[model samples]
Target: MILRTEIATILKAPPIGETVTVMGWVRAWRGNRFMVLNDGSSAETLQVVVDGEQFDEETIRGIGFHAAVSVTGELVESQGAGQAVEVIAKELTILGKTDLSTYPLQPKRQTMEFLRENGQFRMRTNTFSSVFRLRHAVAFAINKYFNDRGFYYLHTPIITGNDAEGAGEMFRVTTFEPDSAPRDEAGAVDYGQDFFGKGTHLTVSGQLQAEIGALALGKVYTFGPTFRAENSNTSRHLAEFWMIEPEIAFADIDNDMDLAEDFCKYLITYCLENYLSDLEYLDARIVEAEKNLPKDKRRPMGLLEMLRFVVEDDFARITYTEAIDLIMRSKPYKKGRFEFPVSWGVDLQAEHERWLVEKHFKKPVIVRDYPKDIKAFYMRLNDDDKTVAAMDVLFPYIGEVIGGSQREEREDVLRQRMQEMGVHEEELAWYLQLRTFGGAPHAGFGLGFERMVQFITGMGNIRDVIPFPRAPRLADF
Candidate 1:
């Protein structure tokens, strides 16, 4: 088989007289005769120009957008206005045709809502092609960041026995009807008939599983899907989201913070280097019309440089108590009550995070040493007793992209902490076993992947960046 390379690769090469084959989807028609075709190769649309002699409009009529085609012709170099050179086709074959009327991905612009409805077809469009391609680059960079650091990638169970965070943040599952389930003599429903022995739910965090592995393997990380039952209808919150968690044994609070910052910088840099061209193509063609959207509205910068800046600079850290003091001193809103009230001990709200990152610090800020009452019980208690060694990395556009902590490693301390925190002792004996054993001190962090995509792409709504975003009241794809 005489194989042919992509049309874009041969654009500036020696194709003047040699006949070569190029396969791609018809992206558009320019002038009265020439047509552009793509192979879904990269973020770019490879151009194939046609001269009316052997490749007349009547020769290939009514071949609508996204129609698959093959052009066998000489690759020539020229100073044509529309496309660089041209494909003076020896033969043009329309392999697959689409109806122009309802193809959904025409040359004209479509709304994000409209494109979302055609998510399956939207990838064929230039916009989603770039978004998803960049998404792939970032994900690869995320894993490579940890793997290069001698960290083992641990596959945590999706069906969890216990929720990592004691916030009742899990989606309960059952084979039987939920409402009419059988009960025990004590009126509490017996869960033997449930899916996973006692009861099971989608995991809210992989921190616990990562903990088990980290204690044994010494250093570990988990990149997997997580679920939260919280009825959040905001752009930043998702019922099902991807989380990246790295756990290390014998690591202190400071060590965990260092890892968190380095990991972020590594991911950003990796994507920027590998996917800068793809992003530019995606931005120019597919999303050019949609730049008016808040997320796409930001001044464009090279993805590679942005990533380098993230890793190259020192990230600022401020304690939750200090952050609250700053907010109080500045007084974000001059008068009225806050929608999500805040104080020294309160959990930081999205608005509060936005204010701190967007207005106050104006950089990637890690708000650390959170109030214990508002954080997970697994966090190490600070010397002051009121706060814990927990941190949340907040950025300008995306509020809280990461949450981390130095875990409670002491057996007696952990047991007492669990009980005092009102977490069920019976449901967590397995987790407690790690503490009972060699259990050296360990710490880890969980980064919301979708939120990171939203941050990187500057896409306002989380839905657009994800392939098929799963959020409350919006599961359409």
Candidate 2:
């Protein structure tokens, strides 16, 4: 039996003169002698040199771009200038032949839009592969960062009855026919006949359930898929995406802030050290992509520099009021250049967040103590009765990367807040009971995993980072 070797491993430590079997799709072929093969193992490709005279003529002719092939080769030091090692093909077998005439991907530059249209096959591209590799590294780093700190990886439910964010953007799950479901006395659609015996939806966030895990297990984190049904067609919004939510028991808002900052820094540092090659490639891509943009729109720091800065520098910590004051006094707002209104009570828009992180701070900023009305009801109420102990970690290009708060532990306060926010107290009885019992001060935050990848990979569109993005009217395979 022949041993299969990945292209990455062969390229890393080429076993000179050792026979190995390499299997992957052909990326490119030149003069039927040199073929670049990629197996999605690493961002790099293996240069397979074949002797056509020794191999079957049909096999040599079958080799084409995107054709899956098995190449039995001897690893040898490369004579080529671009790579260090190349494989000398002893025998070649075409496993799958892809017709280039109908293939969506070509051996040329492709726009993000075109790549997204062919998302089913986009992972084969160097850019998407690099982005996904970095994404994997970031996720692994997240688990390691938590696991090293004695945090249990919790798997929360994907479907739930509670509106975690109270945003009312949940995707409804029902068994009844739409517009033809049984109606009650009030002429409202009867939910009792539904599959779950009540209204259910795809979860918006796992933080609420993660709190249960934290209460029972002390510290827990959830990395899972979440859904939102908002019809947003932007570079940032996604109908479905993964979220990393960590809940810590007996921790206050300050502790949450500390944990959030440390977590962000750890992820950035992990990628910088582990995925530097992919990062370097992405950095160059970002620089080249921004070259056509306006002078003022281009980022001041490259991808690696930005990641290093996040790891080295401390995140600027400020209160929401402080940020509002800065925004109001800034040139954009003063000169009426800001598109969104920047009042003290109004929620911070993307424009306001960018100015705070990109222009004013020039670093990641953790803005806490937002106005109570503008934030979720579960956030702990401050003594002033005006603001909640909520925090948002804003990034340079991405506005809000993480959002969390110190949950209200007191049953009376929690119930009152729920009532004021029009959340049904009966439906969340189990959740509210946590406060009724020995509910200690708990804090947690939800980090948009896709957005983090976007920031890390220097990719502008959120759709490019996720494997298959679910967005408004765009669920292409």
Per-residue error for 244 in candidate 1, Å, reads: 0.9
Which regions of candidate 1 are displaced past 4 Å? 7-18, 82-85, 177-181, 186-188, 281-312, 331-341, 473-477
Clashing pairs in 2: none
What tens-digit string does per-residue lDDT give for candidate 1 at 1-477? 847678557753645767888888887887656777777666655556676766556657756778888888877765566556677777778788898777667788788788878788888877677778778877888777888888899999898778788778678877768688878899887888676778888888888888988988899998998988877887667788899999999998889888888778777766666667665664454345555668645533433334444566677899988888877766655454347766777787877787776667766789899988888889988888788999988766457878899998877777878888998878888888888878788899988888787666656678788887777776764
Error of 2 at 171 (Å): 1.5
lDDT of 2 by residue, 304-402 (tens): 887886788789999999999999999989899998887889899888998998889988899999999988889999999999999999887678899
Best model number under lDDT: 2
TM-score of model 2 (CA atoms): 0.95
Worst 10 residues of 1 by lDDT: 299-308
- What's the C-alpha lDDT at position 120 in model 1? 86
Model 2 local distance difference test score? 0.89
